[model samples]
Each structure stands twice: as C-alpha cells, then as structure tokens.
Target chain A: MSNKKNALWHLPLIIIGIIALLPVIFMISNSFKTLQESYQSILSVIPNKPTIDNYTTLNHQVNLVRLVWNTFFMATLVTVGKLFTGLLAAYAFRYYQFKHKNLIYLLFVATIFVPFTIVMIPNYLVIAKLNLLNSVIGVALPQLCDATGIMIFLKTMEKIPGSLFDSLKIDNIPNRRIFFNIVLPILKPSIISVGAMFFINSWNEYVWPTLILKDKSSFTLPLALQNYISSEGGTNFPLAMALSSIMIVVPLIIYLIFQRYILNSISNSGLK
Target chain B: MHNNKKILPFLYLMPTGILLTIFMIIPIIYTFYLSFFDWNLIAPTKDFVGMRNYIEVFTDPVNQKVLMNTFFYIILLLVLNFIVPYVISLVVKFFIKRMQGAYKIIFFIPSLFSLVVGAMIFSWLLNPVSGPVAFLFRESGFVLPNWTNSGGLAIIVICLITNWKVFGYNFILLLTGLGSIPKNIVDATTVDRIPKWRMIWNIVLPMNKSIAIYVLILTIVQGLQYVFTPINVITTGGPYYGSSNVLYHTYLNAFVLYKTGNASALAITTFLIFLVLLYLEIKFVEGRSRYE
Candidate 1:
C-alpha cells in the first residue's frame, strides 16, 4: 500500500520537474537557433542548425562584459552592505534591550512592507539631492539595509542560548569579540541564506536600477539587455534568448555553489 | 559589574538605532512630507497641495479603476502564487528526496532572471505575429488572443509570467518548511496506518502555518510591485488603460504626466494599505505564536 502511494506521488514529481525545466530547455535550445528557425514552430525543442551568431551579436551590441561587471559589483556591494548592517542590527536586537526596543523593532519590520513604489519617488529625490543619480551607488543604496534581512538574522540569533553570551562575558571577552568570535560563527548559515537572497535580489533588480541609473555607462545586465531589445526591436528572438541564457547562467552558477548553504539557511531561518 | 554590563547592551544597540533613524525612519517621515507638496523635476517652486492631490486621486475615475485593477491582480496572482507552487512543492517534497537539490535548482532558475529580462522574453513570446505563442495556437487550430494588446488577456498573460517567475521561489520556500518537519511525526502517522493524504492534510499543513502566512504576506506585497515592470514594458497600462495598477498609475503620474503630488498621494495610499495588512499579519502571527 505504501509503495503504491509512493509511486503515485513520484509520478507528479517527475511531471512537474519536467514542466519546471521545460522553459529553460526551450530557451537554451532556441538560443542557438537562427531567427528563422525560432519562428517556424513554437514547439521546436531542438535547433535545426545551431549557431553562435546570436551570442556573438549580443556580445557586440550589449557590451556584455561591462554589464556583467556592473551587475556583479552592485550585487556584491549591496549584499555585503545589507549583510553587515542586518547582522549588526540583528545582533543588537537579539543581545540587547533598550528603551522602545520592541517598538523600534516593529518599525524596522514595518519597512519591509513599504512598497518600493511608495519610497521610490522620495528615495529618488534624496539620491538626486545627494548627486548620486546615474551611479551604481544610487542603485544600491536603498537596498543596503533591508528589513527582511535584519528580521531573519534576529530570528537566527534568537536561537542561540543566552548562556553563551554569559559565558563569553565570564571569559572576559569583550562584546565585540563575543559578536565576532562567537555569535557570527554560529550565525554562518543565516548569513549565507540572507546573503544569497540579497545577492540574487540585487542581481535581478530592474525597476529601481533602471530608474536610478539613467546613464548607459552604468547600466546593469538587465538594463543593458532591455536597451538592446528596444533599440534592435523584438524580432531578434535568438539574440534575446542568448542574453536571457547568460542572465540565467550567472545566477545558476552562484546558486549551485551555495545550494546547500542557501537551503540550510532558508530552512533554519524560518523564512519559508 | 552588573550596572556596567547593563550599559553594554545599550551601547551595542546604539549603532543600529542611529543607522535606522538616519536612513529608514527619516526617509519615511520625508515621504510623508513629500506627499503633501505639488512639485516637479523642472519646477523651482513647490506648492503646498493641501490634500488636493489626494482628493483628485480619490475622485478620478482612472485612479479608481487602477486601484480596482491592483486589487484584482493581487487576488488573482495570490491564488496562483499559493496554489500552484504549494501543490508543486508538496509533490516534490513527497518524492525525489535524493534528487531534491537538482529539482530545486531547475525550479529556481527562472526566478534568478532579472524581471526586465523575463518581461522582455515573455513579451516576445506573447507577440501577436511571428511569435511562438501565436504560431502554436495556429498549429493547434485554436485562436490566439493578442496577448500584450488585448486588455483582459494582457493581464492574464502578465499574471502567467509572474507565476512562472515566482513559483520556483515559492516552491523552495515551501520545501524549506516541509524539510523542518520532524521525521518521527510522519513515522508515527505511518505506523498508525493513516492515509498519506490525510496525514499531509491533517498534519503537515497545520504545522507549517507560520511559513504559510509568511509566504502569503510576501506574495501579496511582492505582487503589488510586480505589476510595475510588465505594465511599463508590454502594455504601458493600455488598451483603454485596463492594465494600469496603483504602482503603474503612480509611475505614470510622476514620470509621464509630471503630476508629482498626485503620484505621491497614490503612493501614500498604497503604502498605507500594505502597512495595515502587515500590521494585521504581525498581530495574527504573534497572537497565534502566543496561543501555541
């Protein structure tokens, strides 16, 4: 009976797995096809004559290296910044109690729900006033201190017993050492989880970057690709697919490297 | 030593308080201040709008429609967001424990694509002529709606694109929740001869309430902003402005129309709605946690 039930469950898993992978397979296959072949049939899973012309074209027009660099630089900066700030804040919230602690924590948590649109205009105003418009800093600034990251870190820190802190104090370890030498080591999974999330979010972020960085020189991968599409028109499906393939490939590599850490963090953080 | 130790906690907390106050708290207060003014990029003088913008936004038929459309999209996307991914996650969790990592990577790849890139790709796929979707319908002997141009279909297509982009992340989140369930509980249910479906329905789902609520809140909040890109790229909130959401409407007001005050008003309203929802969620979760 258990075997039959297990078999029934496995059937859906196999089917959904295929469905989940279908678009990616479709994308990669079409990326190598000529534009003519892409339109011949929507259901075409294999290219008739695969070519690298689409990739070559994208490489030339999109300035792929610079775009990738900008994306990586911005994503890394934002991720690191958010991690530091979030960790510090979480540490503070977890290990310390002060006036209006709960109230302040609630306020920070409240910002998580403040739609980016609501803050976009004012944030732009501030960025503009600071003369940071059209720069990577402008694009990465608002994301540097995420409320969700802080909350995740706080939750993770809460899991650590208070006795650890007391013991650290007894050993005459300073608060700074307690944070760095003890708290941070145990918070590694949470940091990895939050860092991966922030990295992916910053890497994939479009609207804010598009709005903030109007200069072509500072364009991230997504913005650069969008410009390529708008300028060239949407007829070059193969080229677009090639660019899409590159976009997916980069993050997929990161995710693969950090898959276990990411999963562990997600599960442990209670963020699921 | 005890008094000095008490002071250390405050010292530890001071940096975060300062940073939050300077960055987040101050900016939110500034947002409130900006919402009351009529200002533009090119203009030197700022006029005190005195609730005029809010009144105009509330009274405008277009704004009303956009508000309704925002709610409609949220409701529709929420259903897709929860149901499809939850079911897929449950199925994936049930089987393929050994190959779960590979399955997760495959599912999450789309979510890693930039929203603009995803939007552009889908926009191409949904192109009326010389597009794959159209060609497929033709081959299948079925009519294809002009997805990006047709009013109702455009929204549905956008929803589908969002579903494709987000379902993997949702699935991973659900999988994470499922992973945390103690194996002994499941073993007990099995040893008692309880049916698997009944066990999942009666046991697993109930145990994952916090995760479920977290996902729900994130989906609703994220879905509101998701409308911004598609509305910008594909329709520009067109076909008699059917696709105009609150976010898109605010974008149009500020960028296109140069009505900064009206845009700010719209933004304020959007912020308030989500804030209220979040407050209720926090209350609900906290209350439940206490009860448990």
Candidate 2:
C-alpha cells in the first residue's frame, strides 16, 4: 500500500515536470526546422527535414556574435563592479567600528526595498544628461550598486566567530591584508554564489537595457532578441526560435555549472 | 583616533555611496521632482503641472482600468504564483524522494532565460496560426483563440507565464523552509502516529509561517510589475487596457506616451503604496515573532 502511495504521489510531479520543460524542448526542436517546416510542423516534436536556414538568416539580419559579445561585456562589467562594491562595503561593515555605521548600513540595504520604477525615470534622465544614452557604459553604470549582495555578505560574515578576526588583529595584520588573506578565503563560497547571482540577474535584465539602448549595434542579447521577435514575428517562426535558443545559452551554462552555489545561497538567504 | 578610524570606513563606503546616490538616491529625488512637471521629452523646458498630473491619474478612466487590472494581477499572482507553488513545493518534499534534482532543474531553466525570451517562446506556443496548441486543437476540430488578443485571457496567460518563470524560485525558498524544520519535530509527529496530511497541516504549515509570510510579502510587492514583461512583449497591454497593470501602464506613460509627469506621479504613488504594505507586513511579522 505504501509503495503504491509513493507511485501515486510521483505521478503528478512527472507530469508537471514535463509540462514545465515543454517551451524549452519546443524552442530547441523547432530551431532546427525550416521556417516553412516550423510553421507547418506545428504539432510535431521532431522535424522531418532539419535545416540550419533560420540561424544563417539570424546571422545575416543582425550581428549575432557582436550582440553576444556586448551582452558578455556588460554582464562582466556589472558582475565585477557589483562584487567589488559589495566586498568593500561588506568588509567595512563587518570588520570595523565607525560613527553612524549602523545608519549607513541601513541606508545601503534600504535601496533593496525601493522598487526600480521609483528610480527608472531619473536614471534615464541622468544617463541622457550625461550623454551616455545609447552607449554600453550608460547601460551598465547605474547598476553597479550591490545592496543585495552586501546584505547577504553581511549576514554570512556575522556568523563567523569573532575570535577569527580577533586572532588576525592580534597578529597586527592590516585591514586590507586581513581582508585578502583571511576574510576572502572564508567567504569564498558566498562570493562565488552571490557573484553568480549578480551575473545572472545582469545578464537577464531587459527592461532597463530596452530603455537605455536605442542603436541596434549596441543592443544586448535580450534587447536584440526582443527586437528580433517584435520585428520578425509570424513571418520567421524558426528564426525567432533560433534567437530564443541562442539567447539563453550563456545563462543556461552558468546556471548548470554554478547551480549548487546558486541554490545554496537562495536557500540560505531566502529562508532567513 | 576616532576621526582616523572613521576615515577608513568612510573610504570603504565611498564607492557604494557614490554609485547608489547617483543611481538610486538622486534619481528618486528627480522622479519626485519630475512628478510636478509636465515633460514631454522634447521641449527645452518642462511645464509646471502642480498636482494636475496627480489629479489626472486619480480621475482618468484609463487609470481606473489600470488600477483594476493591477488588483486582478496581484490576486492571480498570489493564487497562481505563491499559493500553487507553495503547495507544489510541499508535495514535492513529501513525495518523490529520488528525482528531486530533475524536477528542480526543469522548473528552474525558464527562470535562467530572460523574460523577453520566455515571452517570445510562449508567444509562439500560443500563436493562433502556427502554434502547437492551435495545431493540436485544429486537428481535433477545435480552434484556440488568439490568446494575446483577448484582454482577460491575455492577463491570465501573462500571469500563468509569470508563475511559470517564477515558481521555481519560490519552490526553492519553500523547500529550504521545509528543510530547515527540526528533524526531531518531524520524527515526533511520525512517532505520534500522525497521518501525513494531518502532520503537514497541524505541524508543517505552522512551522513554515515566516517563509510563507516572506513569500506573501514579496508577491504583494512585486506582483504588479511581475506581469510587465509578458504584457509588454506579448500583448503590449492591449485589448483596450484589459491586460495593463499599473507598472506597464506607468512604462507606457513615460516611454510610449511621453507623459513623464504622469508616469512619475504614478510611480511615486505605487512606491508609497508598496512602502505602506511592506511596513504593515513587517509589523505583522514582528508581532508574530514576539509569540515565538
């Protein structure tokens, strides 16, 4: 009876899991079809005659390589900038005693509560005023603050025994040296996990990039992909599908590789 | 000595302080300032509207529809995204011991993709002419309506897609919530000969209150904007404002309509509303914590 009960419970999960994967499976499978075949073979999972025409067409329509590079460039800059800011701020808040420290720390975390909409317009105006609009720097500069990471790092840092820091202080180690030699090594897991989260969020960002980037050449993959879909919808289903497939490549790879860290961080931070 | 110590921490804070003030603080102030002026994004100077835009946002029929749609969106999100996912997480935890990894990966893959891509993929699936669903239904002598063309259906579809891309995050959150429960408490219930369903209700649910509250507050705060991607990409908040939530409506006001004053006012109002909601949620959570 218990064995049967387990099977019964498992049945819905199996169904739901397959349902969840349908769009991904469809996207990959349909990308290989000709536009005509993609439209015609609507219900078919496998194409009768797979073709690479859509990808070639996509390459011709837009510089796929350049778009991917732009995306990588922006995501990398954001990751590095956020991690640097978060590291310094978290380290300062963790290790030092200073006037108004609690107040400053609260201010840092307070940004997390404010919706992006509150700042979206002014951010655009600032970027426009600075003449960074339609530039990659404009797209990246406003996003470098890492309130979420600092909060996570601060929490993680608090759990470490004070004796560890006290011993390092007893050795007369400077703050910078202690940060590099001791703190970083201990917080390696958090850095990796939080760093990956930052990278993924930056990479997948769309609305802000859409608001900032106007020139097609400056378009990140999500923006470019959105342009492709809106511009080419209904006519080239296969090409659109190809674009979708390519767009998720880096993020999918990152998630697969760092999933353990990512999941660990999510569980750790979210539950607490 | 005190001054010297203060200098180091301040230096450590400089980067974040500079960036956030420029990006977050200054812009927020600017948004508030802009809310008073009618800036169409063209003229050399903005016209001082002096609460005119706020009055329009409150009195306009289109804004009324937006308010309703936002309410509906939040309700659907709570039901589909929060409650359903929480239940699914519980079910997954209770059953299916072996294939947990597979289930999580599959659910999570969509979230890794940008919302734009996810919207496009689903758009293709729901396409009336060449979509798989259409084709399947057409084969059975039934036709699938253009899902994005209908206002009500579009909102529902957008909410469903939002849940699809999002539920994985909440699932992981709840999974961890369940994981963090004391093993001894669970074992005690089992030894007490409690039925699984009874144990889940009487013990598990109550124990997971904080995480549930966390999820609830997040949904309330984010639910308005969560539908933006799908509404923008799929329907463009169309079918006569049926699918337009306040966030998307705000986006249209500033970007599409160039009504910067209206958008800013709308944004500020939305922020203030959410701030109150957040405060109340914290108060309730804190109140509950006192009992613990």
Candidate 3:
C-alpha cells in the first residue's frame, strides 16, 4: 500500500519534468536549422539538413565578442559597487544605534517598490543633461545604490553576534577597521549571495539600457541581440534563434561557474 | 562616547537615505506632479491641466480595454507562476534528496538568461511557419495556433515563456523551505504510517505558508514588469490593440503620442494598484507571522 502511494506521488513530477525540458530541447534543435527548413516545419526536433550557417551569419552581423564584453563590464561594475556600498551600510546598521535609524531603514526598503517606469523619463533627462547618455556609467549609475542589496546585506549582518564587536573594541580597533578586517570576512557568504543577485539582475537588464544607450557600439548583449532581430526583420527565425542561443549560453556559463555560491546565497537570503 | 556612537549610525545611513529620497521618493512625487500637467520634453513651457489627463484616460474605451488586459494578463501570470513552480519544486524534492545542489543548478539556468533572450528563444520555438510547436502539431495532424497573431493566445504565450524563464528561482526557494523542515517531525509522521500525500498536504504545505505568500507577492511584482519587455518585442501590443496592456498604453502615450500628462496619469494608476497589492501582502504576511 505504501509502495503504491509513493509511485503515484512520483508520477506528476516525472511528467512535469519532461514538460519543463521540452522547450529547451526545442530551442537547441531549432538553432541548427536552415531558414527555409526551419520555416518548412516549425516543430522539427532534428533539422533535415542541420547547418551552422545561422551561427556564422549571427557572428558576422553582430560582434558577439564585443557584446559579451559590454555585458560583463556593466554587470561586474554594478555588482562590485553594490557589494561595497551595501556592506558599508549593512555594517553600520548592524553594529551601531542612532536616532531615526529605523525610520531611515524603513524609507530605504520602501523604495524597493518604486517601479523603474516611474523614473525612466527623469532618469533619461538627468543622464542626457550630464552628457552621460550612451555611456556604460550612465547605465551603471542608477543601479549602484539598489535598496534590495542594502536589505539583504543588513539582514545578514544582523545575525553576527554583538560580542564580536565588543571583542574588537577591546583590541582597540576602530569600528571602520573592524568592519573592513573582521566583519567583512565573516560576511563573505552574504556578499557572494548579494553579488550573484546583483550580477544576474544587472546582466538581464534591458529597458534602462535600451532607453539610455542609443549608440550601437555601446549596446549590451540583450540590446544588441534585440537590434539584430528587429533590424534583420523578425522572419529570420533561424538567425534569431542562433543569436539567442549565444545569449543564453554566456549566462549559463557564468551561472554554472558560480552555481553553488549562487544557490547557497539565494537559500540563505531568507527571500523565500 | 554614547553620543558619538549614536551620531555615527546616522552618518552611515545618510548616504542611502538621501539617495533613496532624491531618486525614489522624489520621482514618485514628481510622477504625480507630472500627471497633472501637459508637459512634453520638447516643449519649453508646461500648461497645468488639472484632472484632464485622468478624465481622458478613464473615459477612453481603448484605455479601458488596456486596463482590463493588464489585469487579465497579470491574473493569468499569477496562476502560472504559482502552480508551475510549486509542482516543479515538489518533483525536484522527490528525485534528488542527496543531490539537491546539482538539481538546483540545472533548474536555475533559465532564470539567469535575459528576458529579451528568453523571449527571442520562445518566439522562435513558437514560430507558426517553421517553428518547433508548429512542426509538432503538423506532424501530429493538427493545425498550429498562430500564437503571435492571436491577441489572447499571444499574452498566454508570453506568460508561459516568462514562467519557464523564472520558475526555477521560485522552485529553489520552495526547495529550501522544504529542506528546513525538522527531520524529527517527518520521522514521527512516517512512523505513524501517514501516507506521503497526507503528510505533505497536512504537514509540509501548512508549514511553508509564509514562503508561499512571499512567492505570491514577488510574482505579482514581477508580472507587472514582464509587460515592459514582451510588449516591446513580440506584438508591440498589436493586432488592432488586442495585446495593448496598461503599461504598453502608457508607453505609447508618452513616446508615440507625446502625451506626457496622460502617460503619467496611467503610471500613477498602475502604481496605486501595486501599492494596494503590496500593502495587502504585508498585512497578510504580518498577520500570519503573529499567528505562527
């Protein structure tokens, strides 16, 4: 009776797993097809005559290497900035008490809900006025002080014992010194977690980059790929699929490299 | 010493506080302010148009349809986001008890991809003429539905794509919640001969209520933003405005029509809806916490 029940429970999961993987398999197979062949039979899992022309054309049309560099540059800068600023803020909030601290923290977390759409117009105006438009910094600046980063950092910092601060005080260390030397080492996991989140968010960003970045030279991977598709005309389904395959592959590589750390961070962040 | 310590915390928090105030709070207030005026980026001067933009937006039939479409799409996405991830997490929990780490990495690959990229991939997969779905249907002797051409189906396709892209993150969250359950409690239930289904239904699901609510709130927030990308890409909210959602309509108003005031009005309305949903979520979570 127990065996029967367990088997029944496993059925739904097996079916769902196959369903979940179907599209990914379809995407990979479709990427290899010729334009005519792809259009001839949209659902063909195996191309009748598989060709590498789609990838070759994608490479020629868009500088894949440059686009990857642009994306990496922005994501890395934003991730590093958030880690630095967020750690500083988190350490201060965790170790010290001040007037209106709660109120200030409240206001900071509240800003998380402020949608990007509300500020896109003004942000554009500010970036243009500063002559920062079409620059990577212009794209990176708005993301530097993310409230979610602060919240995650502070939450992690709160878990450290007060005794650690007292011991540092006994060692005649200043708060800033203690934060940099001791507290930071202990907060590595949180840093990794928040860094991964920030990197992923920055990497996947499109609307801001699309609005602020006008030069094709400055386009990140997503924007470059979008331009490739729209300009090439959307009918070049195989070429579009090829570019997308490249786009998807880069992030998967990064995530796989840091897969354990990223998952550990997500689970630890208590975001669930 | 106490006074100095107290002041230090304020100094540390000042940077974040001031930045949020200027960038976040001010922009929100300015969105409201902009909504009441007929201002354009090209125009030198602004005319104060009190309630006119709101009136036009509320009265327009197209705006009404867009608003409905927005809510409809959000609802559809909410259901998919909840059900798909929950089922996926459960299956993942069953398969890899010891290899949970490896399973997580496999599932989370999709979430790391950019929305534009994911949409592009799905757009290819769903291509009616020579796409995978169309090919499958043709092979099976069934006609393929023109996903992009059909307004309602296009929205559903967008939601499914979004679900596929992001569900792994949520699944990981649920898996973590499941992992945190005390072993002793599970062992006791098992010894009592409580069936796996009964144990999950009565024990595990109830224990993870908070996590479920968190997922729900996050899903709603994400669902709103999903409109921005899909609208920009696939349909541009088209087929005679069949797919035009509230956010897309606002984009059209500001960028295409150059009606800043009307766009701001639509933005404010959307923000209010989000605000209400957020507040309700907070209250619900807080209430549950107290009970727990």
Candidate 4:
C-alpha cells in the first residue's frame, strides 16, 4: 500500500522545514552572538564567541523575573478558570436532558465565533470602570471562560459511554458522585491537553493585555519582549533575541512533552 | 435533594453562561450602544451623533482604505494559510510516504509559539538594512527594500511572519484529514485505474470536505486575527495607515485616538461582516456538502 518513492521531493520538503524553523534558529544563534559578531555574521547559526552580555543587558532593561511571573500567573489563572467552568458545563450537557439544552449549548458555541476585537473596547471600559487597569487580574478576568475548553471537553465526554452514567443513575447515585468518581479519571488526559492549549493561548495573548496591563511589572514576557516594538525598548538586537529565547522556553518544553496528545486533540477537533 | 435533577444541570451551566454573558453578550450589546455616540473617553458629554459615525466609517478615506486592506488580508490569508497548506497536506498524504513524522514535527514546532513572538523574531530576521537577507543583498551590490515603508510590502511582511507560524499548524490539520481518508476508497480508485489527480479531485477531496471547510473557515476566522500581533509589532499599520486591518484599526481608534464612538461603529461593522461571512460559509460551503 505504499506509494512510489521520490528523493527529489525530499529536497523541497526539507527546504520548507528549514524555512519554517528559520526564526527559531536565528533566535537561538543570534542571542549568544556579540553585537559585533551579530552585525558581522548575519548569516551564522553558531556564534563564533558566545557571550552572556545580551542577557545581562536585557536583565537591566526589564525585570525579566516579574515579566515571566506575570505571564505565568495570568496564563495559569485563565487555564484553571476556563477548565473549571468548561468541565462543569460539559458534564451537565453530556448527562442531562434539561430545558433549552440545545439552546444553551449553542450559546456556548456561539461565543467561540465572536472575535475579540468586536468586544474589546466595551470590555476595556468595563475593566476601567471596575478600576482593574494596569493589573494582571484585568488581563485574566475576561479570558476565564473559553468556549474552546467546553467544546474540547464535550468532545472528550463523548467517548465515555452513556450507559456508564445511566447505570449509575438507576442505582440512585447522585450525578455529582458519577462525575467526580468516574468522569474525572477518564477525562484526565483530555484535561491536560485542553489545559496545555489554554495555557499556551493565554501566554501568547497580546491585544487584550496591551489594553489592560500598562505598567512594566504587569507586563508579560510578550510585552517585555516588545521593547523592540517601540523604539523605547532600544535598538539592541541580541538582547531582544535573548528575551525571545527566554519567553519561548516554557511553551517549547510544554509543547514537546505534550506534542503527541496536543496533535491528536487538534486533529480530532478539526474533524468535527 | 430530589429537586437536584432540575437544578444541578443549570447550576453546572451557570458559570459558563454568566461568564459568557458578562464578557461576550453584554459587551457586544454595549459596543453597539456606544457606536451611536461620539465620546473621547474623558470628555464630559457624549454627543448623540446618530448615523454620522456610520457615515464616517463609510466615507472616511482612511477607514475606506483600511476596509479594502482587510479584504486583501482575507484573500491573501486564504491563499497562503488555507489553500497552500491544504495542497501541501494533500501532496504529502498521498505522494511522499517517507519521513512524514519529520515533516509534521518540523511544521508543528513553530505553531507552539506565539504569533507575537513570531512577529518579533520576523522583525529582527527581515530587518532591511542589516538582516541576513539584507546582508546577502549588500554582497550582491544591491540594497534591500524596506518592507515597513511600503503599504503592500508591509502587509506582505506581516502576513508572511504570521504565515511562518500558522502554515505548519494548518498543514498538520489538513494532513491529518487527508490521512484519515480510508485506504479502501483509494484502492477502489486504483481498481478502476483512476489517475491520482482525478481520484484526489473526486474521491479523496469530497470525503475530506467537512474538515477542509472547517480549516477554510478557520483560516478566515483566526487568520485575520493573527495579523493583529504582526501589525502591532512590525508595522503598527504605518507608512500612512497602510497595513491596518479592522482588528488593529479598532484598537488604534479606540485606545489611541480615544474616538470610542468611531471605534465602536467600526467594530460593530466588522462583526456584522464576519457574521454574514460565517452565515454564508455555513450556508454555502458547509451546506453544499449535505447533498453529496
């Protein structure tokens, strides 16, 4: 059942792979290069004489510790919040035949299609009115309820046979018991994959946070890395790359560890 | 506790419902309400401008051009992110059989990082004066063109950076869909001596249409959204508002200009556009599949 082999096709695919990874390669290599070397050998993947100077310069320019902490706190808050809400709602939908059941589920799904840009301004005013501006809570609050979590959880719940829950129901077991005792254990992998997605999305988030978190202490790594966005961050190339390298390390590790599960979840989700 | 049957389901649904209401539904309604008034945030009064803001959205040259640019962004995104990746997945799935995992991993690595980070790395890599490409050009006795300075090139630069991040992701999704197509179908095509291209165009494609449409719709839905980070990082819709799309333009108008009214009007307008676009997509692209 194998198709014809062609070595020529491998060349183009390999080239595309390199193109895909060029920025990452550039970031890693250039972060260690001296300013002189960076400018001199713009094409090099390995630094001739690597130095820690760029990391130190970036350390002085911004509080890298606070930036990482801020991003981690906000992303974790979002992931936990979304996962908690999503799990409860998904369990209810899967087990119950409540009134407006279809309508309520549709409502959750509808939120997925509402682009953030449309609602951002109003949300800003609301956040400002509540005086949450320049705060990590401001960034985390609006993101807490993601429909993607509910969607993913619901899809996972589909794998748990209805008879499992129904048999428990005939035994006069409370739904809560069934959910905590049975569904929870079965759902551990789905939870991890969904949590990974939620964490990564919130970590990578920029626009909403830009509107909310104004102070340097409140700035996430993305915000911190964005000194180059404005000239105010200065024209230090290697330093910026150093910041990027630091920012990506956590997500890269999480991604590698969860790559198989994440890919399966995405492909499975994509099908339906 | 006997009443738990009616109540527990709702209680479970409550948190999600309330959060979505506060964040999504109410905010959307509030945005529409704000669209009618002219206010600069700190101003004491909001002038009831009626249709004037909508009129401005229609007639303002900058807004008009930005609207056009958003259209171009949609088309370019479809080409680069949707069509290109789907084609790659098709070719890879049916043709090249070796090292598929290597290709998938290579593509998926970039998808794990943020578009904002991608934008920054891209900005550094594509630096016109002193970047690697620029360095290459200098060796050839030619100067590299500044992408940020030109409107079209700036848009292209922004999309390409985004393309670097998303192309692999969408490729993986479509490739998975192509791979999931049953082997027996392809075998039947072989029994009839159907050519690869025709079999693909007829059998494999039709079978994969739903996921294909999902990815297609996603390319428009999330694709334009990806432009926000790159537009912010790289161009800031600069060179005279050249690369700005509706998403970032809304941010600029509301936050930067403090023209909250106009921003709301623009937001509501774009929301409607996307809604209609989605309806049409579901009705047309998704609807057509049922008959087959």
Which lDDT tens digits does candidate 2 get at residues B162-268? 87788788888888889888888888977998887999998899989877887777776766666787788888899888899888888899999999999998888
lDDT of 3 at B288: 35
Q: Is candidate 3 or candidate 4 better by DockQ?
A: 4
Worst 10 residues of 2 chain A by lDDT: A104-113
- Evaluate model 3: give its lDDT: 0.74
Local lDDT at B231 for model 3 = 69
lDDT tens readout by residue for model 4, B111-204: 8787877887777767897577777788899988998788888888888888888898899889888878888988898899988899999888
Query: What residue pairs clash in candidate 1, if any at all?
Result: none
What's the C-alpha lDDT at position A98 in model 4?
73
Regions of candidate 4 where Cα sits further than 4 Å from its true position: A1-5, B141-143, B280-292
Among the numbered candidates, top DockQ falls to: 4
Cα-lDDT of candidate 4 = 0.83
Native interface contact recovery, all models: 0.54, 0.69, 0.42, 0.72
My TM-score estimates for the predictions, one after another, are 0.91, 0.94, 0.90, 0.95
lDDT of 4 by residue, A1-272 (tens): 14324666567688889988888988888889997888788568999998998899888877878889899999999999999999999888888887777667655755656788788987888899999999989988888887767777888888999898888889998766888889999888888888888898888888888889888778988887776657665666787788889988988888889888887777766755
> Best to worst by lDDT, what's the order?
4, 2, 1, 3
For each candidate, the DockQ is 0.51, 0.59, 0.44, 0.59
Clash totals for all candidate models: 0, 0, 7, 0
Per-residue CA lDDT of model 2 for A1-272, tens digit only, reads: 87888788888777777767787888888899977777677557888898888888888988888998888889989999998999899888887777777667656745756777888888888899999888878989998877778867877888878788888777877777888887788788888988888888888888888899999899988887777666755467777888888887888888889888888787766645
Error of 4 at A138 (Å): 0.9
Model no. 2, DockQ: 0.59
